[model samples]
Target: MVERRPAGLRHSIKKQMAAVFSLLMMGTILLCWFINNFFLGEYYISKKQNAMFATYQILNMAATNGTLSTDSFDIEFQKNCGKYNINYILLDAESKTLKTSTPDYSTYSQRLLNNLFGENAEHQKLLETGEKYEIQIAEDDRTATEFLEMWGVLDNGNLFLFRSPLESIRESVKLANRFLGEVGIASAIISAVIVYLISRQITKPIEELTGISERMIHLDFDAKYTGKSRTEIAQLGQNINELSYTLEQTISELKSANNELQRDIERKNKIDEMRKEFLANVSHELKTPIALIQGYAEGLKEGISDDEESRNFYCEVIMDEAAKMNNMVKKLMTLNELEFGNEKVEMERFDIVALIRNYLQASELLCRQKEIEVIMEAKKPVYVWADEFMIEEVFGNYFSNALNHIAGKRVIDVKLNRHDNLVRVSVFNTGEQIPEDSLPHIWDKFYKVDKARTRAYGGSGVGLSIVKAVMEALNQKYGAVNYDNGVEFWFELESAGEKVDDEKGMETEESQNG
Candidate 1:
């Protein structure tokens, strides 16, 4: 059963990063709001007080320079007074107004005169006092409005009063804080969304790395991190890719080693079994010849045969058995060399048709004795790539086996056919068909279809096995096919084409004959 992970924002790094960033932004906005609420009002009030002192200085300078009533001074002074929303009255020593910024000059003049005379002193609260001026928070009895007021004596003894409305400054500070709160909330929300999207982009590579790790757990190394980022995450992904490649190569080599180990063990066991079977077959085959030779020798020793011909007969029997044993031993050695890869196969281009004809010519007398008709279907030279000696041995085995088995029509058929780049040579003799069940095992060492018939023909049951080994060494194909009246043994070799010079062909044939 496969396990599944629960899906939720709680387990997501993207969500966590978004939440943390949004919280920081919100915290910053709230900090700004709190600072504005607590300090913005006092800051505005301090700025207004500074503006009033600046007005006082400029008016006192103009009065001393005798330019207090000039149109230039009046224009500059009025501009400053309007910018700060200040109401002012300027009076000479005669208590006559020199310049007044308010439409109702009488009201501001009376206020300034009352301040100098200390009549309205109870209606004021002094904030800062100087040698020539006093700054205060005062209220107007007529309009019930509060002001930051400066009342003082200027140079040349001109009396001046500078006051700005405090209500407007307090209202502006409140409006600014309200505006900041609203904008801060909106900005924090927008900033949070943007940070969340950016965090997701940042985490995309991390997610890819996570998937790669999960696949690695299952030993799949095909998934790779392909991100082109130069961040630490990209470096980590590159490291993981390297680790995955290393592990894949190491594990592949281990698996190959393991498979090779298994094959070695199996081959060793097979070789041991073949050794045991070989010994048993060798012993079995040698038992009869040894028994026959022993019996004939003992008879001759006991003088059982009085006539010289009888003694010669006994000796002949013994010699024949001994010769059979020698032949069997030679075949066994040949089969052993082929099976153990000790036989070196020297490959060369050879005229196979000429070799076949030469072998048939040599065996013509034997064919006549057996009264078997030999038919050759190829007169033209068929050149093929093979070990000439090995191919000759293979052909000899098939011809001998066919000769021994020939019956019915008593005919031997040899053919050479070319297909693509390969030349197939087939030898067919008119005889009993090989049993279907025995066909597959005929190439096995010591396997005979008819044991008695094979024994009569001095067969060691190793000829076809040698054929199998040689064909396998050449990395070619060889097989036997059963027909209705006969079996055909066939083998194929790589073709070397038929376009050789006549002189070269003759030389090759002469070499085989030699």
Candidate 2:
């Protein structure tokens, strides 16, 4: 279990994520405000300038060309002023209003005109002179109302004013700011939540790995990372998990080795006694084969009895004994490697059922010769995790043992039992049941089940021992069960695909019930 961090810790990932999101959102809001305050005004000014220039061209064309009469000109002037939101008064040299586009006399533009002229003859004369004048009406301390007025003398010497208000842009900017505020608040809230959640996801594995490391520092190998993801952090966690397992296994092996070493050092007498016993057994085992070979070779060289068939027979015996010795030595070497933990078990997924069938097929000649019926009970493949080579050796040993020992009915039955995440294969032959006293000693090296049998029928007696070593190396259970009819040798391997079929079976059962 991981301890809770202090509540006052400020460098939490959630806070960091929130801070970064806040900065990004705030920067966006600031940029919106900057564009509204600075560039928006220029944008509005440019639009106003274009509208004024377009209106001037229309009015000047109508007045200069013969395209419009006085009445038609007044209609065109009202249309342009209404479309562009302009209010104006067209005046003659005496300041008489020929046409006015303003519906109300109290408009800001009209009020400005009143304030600028105020019945002053000189001011009226100056404004009517074919010159342009622009003014601003103060609305508040932060804002003002602007109007552009152009005074131009028509070709007939009549004067007119074109006034367009620029205050509509201020309200637009205000509306934009209000919208920006609402959106910015919502964005900040959402981004903060999203970033915080993402940060937790990224940091959760790191925290788990840290806790696992702390436990590992104290030599606890069982604190493994159990989280699953496709991210690099998850991959790192998986690697650390494998490392912990490897460390645990390595340490366990080292401790066992050290204990064995200490025992060996303490019991020098027992070591000497075991060494003597081992050498005696090896010498005794080698003596018969070597003596037979030596005698046969001498007989062949001396041409004893001077018969070709007899010489060939002697040579065959020597060669057969030499082969037996070779097989025994090979088994011994394999046993030594397994017992010393020098052999590396390469694990992979394979169909154990298929392997059993292939081995049975390979031994068909022997089965035929022995008049034995090999029966494999399974049809579908049973996928299991194990060293394929080691499993092959295991199956070969069991099969060979069964063939040599078959008696009644001469039947060999191979059964595969698959359970939760594991598969156990058993080889049973119809033969004499193994003796009760020999059940526990059957896996010992060179301990023959049939003591009367020699190298021709009985093996070096290391097959079962090798099976035990390999099974133990894989950390699984394996043993033999002596039945009334025959002996059943069985061993289990870890499986990778057990749950799939089970799930499918469950679904089928559920559907049937439904």
Candidate 3:
């Protein structure tokens, strides 16, 4: 089977390289476009202004000296301006004449006239008044072709007309674009290679650690991570190595533990199966003997001999043995049902006082036999939500146990009170003190704190276990509270938070139920 790669490692060096390279290319293209369009364009505009100033100075000098039309002056201007890459023009105030160094005059003339002079009367007025002015003029004269037409200006007589060749700037900008493209391409290539190499170096140890992990999956714990890299990767490698060692130890421990758990589960399953089988077996085994003994004892009781005492003794022994066997079978069945998770409880709200009164009535005979008085102090109709039958059984077990264990005057006190959303029912009795060490385990199945005293009173050790199961089934709370005089066994059940108005006859059963 193909193993899965860990999360966060799906992307490789090639993929990362492509992503970085793509972003770098996009950034370079934007920067080059911005410089060519904005910064470099601004530089060209500044150069044009300087050229315009040179033109103005030349004209102003000629105008001062009265040599504005001299051939020598024109030649001197041309010589001084050689290859500055611009057009030269000198116009009278009428704007009817011109001069230049390029032949494509239509586009140049439109731009020149529009920028240097103004429209209609404004151009005329400005020409008459202003000594110098410069403006960008768009042109369609035949002097310039290709590209986005022409860029030039009309000088307002501040200097003899001087124009820079637009072609020179066009060529210079093209060269700038080409130079930037070359530099950017080279930088991107270098960055991609260096970054890819650096990433590979960083990931090398991790890859080795991954291999070690793969080996571990096959129970090959012999391999140790060996690759060394700087801090972070080195730490990662060390962690992987430590994990491998710990995993090996854990696996060894788990092997034995797993075996033990499997055996224990199997043993438990067998015991469960045996428990079911034994219930039937024990019933079959003991029934015949019990019946025979009962028959002999009853036959002897009906004998003509005046031995009433001996007959009564034999009858008591047989009844006692039968009761023990019956109790054992009932407990076995209860435990089985609880373990198999088949206990069903019917839940409803009932008067707590009434339930206790009924239980006390039933257990009064047993309490009297033990010289115990069951004292109940509670509100008349303190209501709680519980399974009535299950709670009754729980109280019966508690009452019987308290009856058997009570010492001296044998007084068992039962109290019912409401606390928040729960109703607490506590049963306290005077008794021999329970051992501190045994309190925690008292809730465990078949756990008896006073084994000798319990057995003397026919305690089966399963009554409390049944009580626990019943409480748990109803999802109620049960616990034991120890005091100096005796132990109080208490439980909490969900209570109905309603108050009855006895004066207005709102205490009707219907209202209380609702």
Candidate 4:
């Protein structure tokens, strides 16, 4: 009996699909974050550095050359800084504002500058020296504010510095922030879409394989999940399909073998039942003859047969019934011993020619009563290793059957031949051909083709079965070959040779064990 397992709801396809989707989504988000915060951030920082470098160049030229008085130099410096949107400022050594190009100055600028550079009173002391020029390039409002807070300036009036416009730097920072925000959103959306598509591509084959496996577990052998193309998923799909096909084939073969075994078991059970019925029939047959013999003997003892002729008749009836009972017992014992593995066959090399001739001579008298002739055809003496008693009984049964069944010319013929390490012997009788439908079952125990004829001839119906068992026990081959006119039962045995004894003994032991 096969036990069924309960279905598990937790391990379904939806759970697997959700797990894959979550992983893919998380991965894409992380990748997009990396590109936005690190790669693009570094890129914008590099552009800012270039702009700052350009600003530094313009401020340095204006501070070193003292070109504040010339409109052409001022215009050139402003134009260079404007090209990259760089802002600059120049100051005298006392930190007094010497030049400026920014317009968005608020009142807080003066305070911030006062805190970073000194007051305008300090400007006079810087002009006293020959080195009266100074330049300052600030990063942005954030950076400058940080510097201003760290470095406090006083009206001590000795030293000062220049500062770039905070408003322009602030504007640049805002623009860079806005650009990065847009890029981050775009990258996240694109990455998510790509990742989802990619995960779908990778997981499709896995999903198909899972489906196929589920169907297979339910005994659906024909499910197929072929891949769409030559990708890893496709290859995975192909491999799974191949595995499914192989598993299906193996399962089919196992089922076929199991079915055949079941049929064979059933057939053997029926045969066992029939064998019991046959035993009962044989017992009744034996008892009938035995009762007759006992009754006749009782009559003789009571002097019921007073005349000599009557006494002789009673005696003949008793002997005849006794003989019949004896024959039945002998056949029964033969079959029983063979079936029970109690009969041991002692095989030896013997001239088959002499055996057949002896059998024919012995049966000649019985055949004469029926106007039947027994004939032998042999090209030469044939030697075979067989049990003398068993082979003789086999021939006797066949000859007897033929004697009863033969019609018209009423002839039984025995032929012998040898071919390469094997000998063939056939017994042919002129009789009605065995029905084709019954040909295959002729060797089954107690199987009668014509029940009435079998009873008339005193046939026990174990003759062909005995022949089959004998041949099998000896490890020889035998079969019935039917023709249009008559049927021939033939058997083949190993040729008598140096190794025949050893092989025959091995076969005998095997059959006994079996």
Residue-level lDDT of model 3, residues 294-390, one tens digit each, is 7767677678346878777677767776776688569757855765567677788888778888778877787777778777645457677788887
Per-residue accuracy of model 2 over 1-514 as CA lDDT, tens digit each: 9785553445866678778888889898889888887788667766665676677667767767855457777787678778877776656566566556766533534444454464322232122222443332222222344554454556665555666655676777778877888888888888888888888887888878888887887789888888878888888989999999999999999999999998888678655765675677678789888999999898878778587788889988988888988988888788778876789999999887778878888889978987899876466656789999999999899988888888888888877665666667788888788888989999887788676663667377778989999999999998888777888888888876655344211222112110
**Which stretches of candidate 2 lie above 4 Å from their native place?**
1-278, 499-514
Candidate 4 segments exceeding 4 Å error: 1-282, 291-315, 418-420, 435-447, 497-514
Better of 3 and 4 by lDDT: 3
TM-score (all chains, Cα) for each model: 0.54, 0.46, 0.43, 0.46
TM-score of predicted structure 4 = 0.46
Considering summed lDDT, which 10 consecutive residues are worst modelled in model 1? 505-514
Candidate 4 global lDDT: 0.63
Number of colliding residue pairs in each model: 0, 0, 16, 0
Score residue 368 of candidate 4 by CA lDDT: 83
Error of 4 at 444 (Å): 5.1
What is the lDDT, from 0 to 100, of the residue 282 in candidate 4? 78
TM-score of 3: 0.43
